[model samples]
Target chain A: MEKFRANLMLCAGTGCVASGSAKVHAALRDEIKKRGLEDELKIVLTGCNGYCAEGPVMAVYPDEIFYQKLTVEDVPTLVEEHFLKGRPYQKLMFKEPEKKTAIPLMKDIPFFKHQVLRVLRNKGLIDPEKIEEYIARDGYLAAAKALTEMTSEDIIKVIKDSGVRGRGGAGFPTGMKWEFASKVKSDIKFMLCNGDEGDPGAFMDRSVMEADPHSVIEGMIIGAKAIGAHHGFIYVRAEYPLAVQRLQLAIDQATEAGLLGKNILDTGFDFVLEIYLGAGAFVCGEETALMRSIEGKRGMPRPRPPFPAVKGLWDKPSVLNNVETLAQISPIILNGAGWYRSLGTEKSAGTKVFALTGAISNVGLVEVPMGIPLRTIIYDIGGGPKKGRTFKAVQLGGPSGGCIPESLLDIPVTYEDIQATGAIVGSGGMVVMDDNTCMVGTAKFFLEFTADESCGKCVPCRVGTKILLDILTDITEGKGKESDIETLEDLARDILASSLCGLGQTAPNPILTTIKYFRDEYESHIVHKWCKAGVCRDLTTFWIDEKMCKACGACLRACPSKAIVGEKKVPHKIIQELCVNCRTCYDTCKFNSIRILPAGFEGDPYEFLGIGAAAATTGEKKGDA
Target chain B: MPRLTIEDLKKIKEKHRADFTLREGGYRAKVTVHMGTCGIAAGARNVMTALMDEITKANLTDVIITTSGCAGLCAREPLATVEIMDQPPVKYCDLNDDKMRVIFKEHIMGGTPVEKYGLVVGSETTY
Candidate 1:
């Protein structure tokens, strides 16, 4: 293929595909071909760009120009004007939401301004299907070094110097794990890549595998060499079909090209790789459980006196690393320990990729160096909370992690820094929550997930989680007493202490952390009988303002319980007894007649409005979704 | 498809570093046309085409022209930025074919620097 002058790189990640980037890609290709500019201008379909909120994103080559939300309709015009006429397309650019100004450059955008990409270095830039592209960008250099030149001791020493920890929620040193596995003196040791990313809002691992599968492969290869393992397995969750498919293809391609399988690079050393499909159990994310699942068992965690490093998969000494951890290996090996250490803090040397989501304007995958403050991620990278809402707190580390309230937003993002706030930086799932989010409801939601996902091997997780979830549910439904909080704390402590695996052991973290930080929200639920965020529908009553009720029967007709009663062209009333608080009346009220009387609401719901009870009830809040 | 030797990996990285790496000096100047939804509506494609035409006409082999996302200033759509190596990127807002030509010749080739239509005085923009 001849070298192209200008390349239009379009995002082919899942989010962008759902948003019609595929059509835009096809249109751009057709337009380029039609204009006979295919020789000079080429189109490359890449993986997820971090700012998914402004997806279907693309960028031009060499010049490094970023574009968002490209539609097929804009392709002809874009080709005509930009490719043929040399005029910038203003309509297709991102406009600042608050400033109402159309900013065409990425540098001016807050979303991409602060991020320092390392693990996600090739994401959204390189075509993942092409192996040459991966190699062309120093992809396998680290693996070659580990295989041909560096001994197992040297590689482990370099990793130790780099200060990278396991990014799978637990911050264990990679070098120590490798050292333990290497010293085990086992002939049939194994290397495993834990790609079973089951966190609700986490997609960093998935994107890494999808966008740069070779990096992970190389990392695993280097790890196998360091640990004296000849065979490796990547346990990816079944839900991520795209990642799995891409990874399988990469494995095949590497094997064909001598990047994998026997005698890689003809270095007189051998390593074989395979993919193990996970059964989509959340507990399988645990290292031992993942190994058990690979061994054709029920994917339950066995107690560890014999951790994977000493005796693991198939009762052989094994080394298991997170998908993100393994991906960093290639870079650290190629760039020296000092180069890796230069990017992040002293203790945590390297960048972290976070699936930045919820209650924020720019929700996408973000990678930042360690020791960067949460304030920078929220305000600088996330563009703060969505419109008109105050930033309340952010949920980090998925279910096993804790919540960080607004007061701790200034804390630096590191393992130690996160632990200081009683939160684990687990899997780098930073879910920003607004003031409108009820802490009680949030904890209950996570408890429900853990309760349902708890493996029945241990009694603490299996039984304790259900009881805790039942209590949280009753609290949200306004059926809790002051003693329930104490009970919840006690039960949560028991679950954390007695649980057999990480899933059960850390299952109570969200509840414990929320109770620790937002105990007032819990006190309000049990004592005041109110949910401040109005998220607990059961704790709030929906009423109709007598004056604002345009006599419209929209609410009355739509009420499933017949709770609303009003005649056409007159005022309406809500029968509180029949009101189940399904939010049907509130959602159906077209004239803004419905008002919520929160539990323990002292003053009249209308009194807070302070208007003639009609228009005051309906000051259409442009609440950011 | 033989196994890549250590020397092959180094050679490939050297060949592709300029494209993937953020550092400059591989190209003379980088011109970016904002191509978000608003930029496309405001004729950024035309601005890009005009810049490309001028670069081709001038026989400038080193200039790299590309497109970018929203400039945060929506009222001023069709944004264009001209960046020279080691210099700050100058964002030129509200452009057309005529303005693009002047930008191509004077700002890009002449290196005289244009500020009237620009937003930021280039400090830390991408290479």
Candidate 2:
């Protein structure tokens, strides 16, 4: 970057690609060539820039000026003004949403300001396709050090001291996992890197594999040496074709550079890496299930005790770690364990990458330190939901993890702390829910996903989830009774206790947590047959309150069902049978005049408010500290 | 390529270290052209040609030039940020051939920024 006057880093990751980064790239190349400034200016296509919403993103090196939401048409003028004149592109910098004023530098933006980039160190900085760019950033230097200077014993101890746990949902200590495999006396033990990121809202693993393929390669080679294994495979989801493609390219580059394959680094340690793609099964994320899939068997979780560390990947002593956990290896090995320990809390050391999305202003990936509070992530980092709507809860761990209510936002993010709040940091997918989201509806959605993806290896997950979903569907559709609540709680506990594998064991999390926190919402559904957010269409009805109605005629115009009957500047009445429970009028009414009433409301609709407006007081009682 | 040794790895790192030297006596001057679509639309290519022609005409080997993606301020698309060693980066905005030529001759070569075209002096960008 310093050798060249400046470098144009164009984001080539998936988000930017969807937003037309390829056109931007071609336009840039053509523009640079036409100017004959090819030698003077270097154009490098980098990976995910993290600021995904306003992509295709680009940043000028040396000066570190940030630009986003670029299109092909903006190329010629950009090349002219920026390259010819030494000036700041004030219009292209990240604009503050409220002020609509551009923030020129990357560090000033709230999205990148809070993140401590260790795993994502190469994000938006280096061209992932070029091994040379990675090398220049000291990519495989850590692996070289481990092979030549440090012993296998030293590698394990440094990782142990660093306290980096498995980032693939389960927070098992990495050092301990490595130590177990290293001690095992086997001729052909394997180092398996799990890239099967199946969580619905999670994409951190995908970003890492796409952005820093060499880092994963370097980590695997080092892990292989430490565990006394010469053969390994990175089990990535078949759905992640780009990740698989990038890893293949990186493997070729590393092999060519003598960093992988007969990796002498002049040392006799010979380690080779390969890729095995799973058929996009969620259960394949489980270590044993992934191994079985690699072995050409059905991807389903088996019982533990003979955990993958003891017997894994073709019945050989092996070590399996997540893509993110492996990326952390090179940094820990290069910077030492103490440096890694400095960033996070005592228990949860190092940073966690989260795919922050759903009802949030900043829709992208964020890697924050483990000790940061949820309130900071939601408020400071995420900009506190989409403006006016209040923050309800954030679904932390997909179907396998539970939701954390607003009251517990003060709790620091750690494996133990998150678990205490009925959610595990399961691969860091923080889906922020708003006031409009129905608690029972949200729970049912996650349940439906697990029920669909349940490998069906055991009865608890296969049958238990089915039954729980049926009850939730009944509750939402106004066919439920009070007895169903206690019945669901009992059934969820039974499934947790008797389920054979992790899938079955964790299937009841969404239902259990929703009932635990939002009991009043569930109670409202059963007793009054009401849905507060109008999400449960069957139990809900819409009516315009005559007192508050400004007679704006907004509801009549906006109604998709055309059920509302009214004249200009007059209060409207919803024709009941034609209403179709659409709630279009409710959303369209600006005067807050339209309200939801239960379908069988015996009296005035004004008196019968939904559960969200009712006394729903079942979450954490303490104020955020 | 031959197998890499510890010495070879060190040499590679050293080369990179020198190439990416960021601070103090690191380099004489470095200029970045914002080339993201936003900049391109704002005529960054013309800026590149103008800057390149001037650099060649001046026969200046000390000054380095490069291109970057969008600086995000698409409104003032044509942008150039200059970094001189031991000094904060200066962003000169809405650059065209004439304004850039003057900046290159006076600010880049003579160490005096053209006040009118310079959007913000120093990289704090606090506002």
Clashes found in each candidate (C-alpha, N, C closer than 3 A): 61, 51
Each candidate's DockQ: 0.20, 0.23
Highest-scoring model, TM-score: 2
lDDT of 1 by residue, A155-207 (tens): 99999999999999888999999999999997799999999999899999999
Which segments of model 2 are wrong by more than 4 Å? A1-3, A546-554, A609-625, B14-127
TM-scores for all predictions: 0.83, 0.86
Given candidate 2, what's the lDDT at residue A451? Answer: 90
List per-model TM-scores for chain B. 0.75, 0.75
Candidate 1 stretches with Cα past 4 Å from truth are A544-580, A584-595, A599-603, A606-625, B14-127
Which CAPRI category fits model 1?
Answer: incorrect
Tell me the lDDT of candidate 2.
Answer: 0.83
For every candidate, what share of the true interface contacts is present?
0.35, 0.36
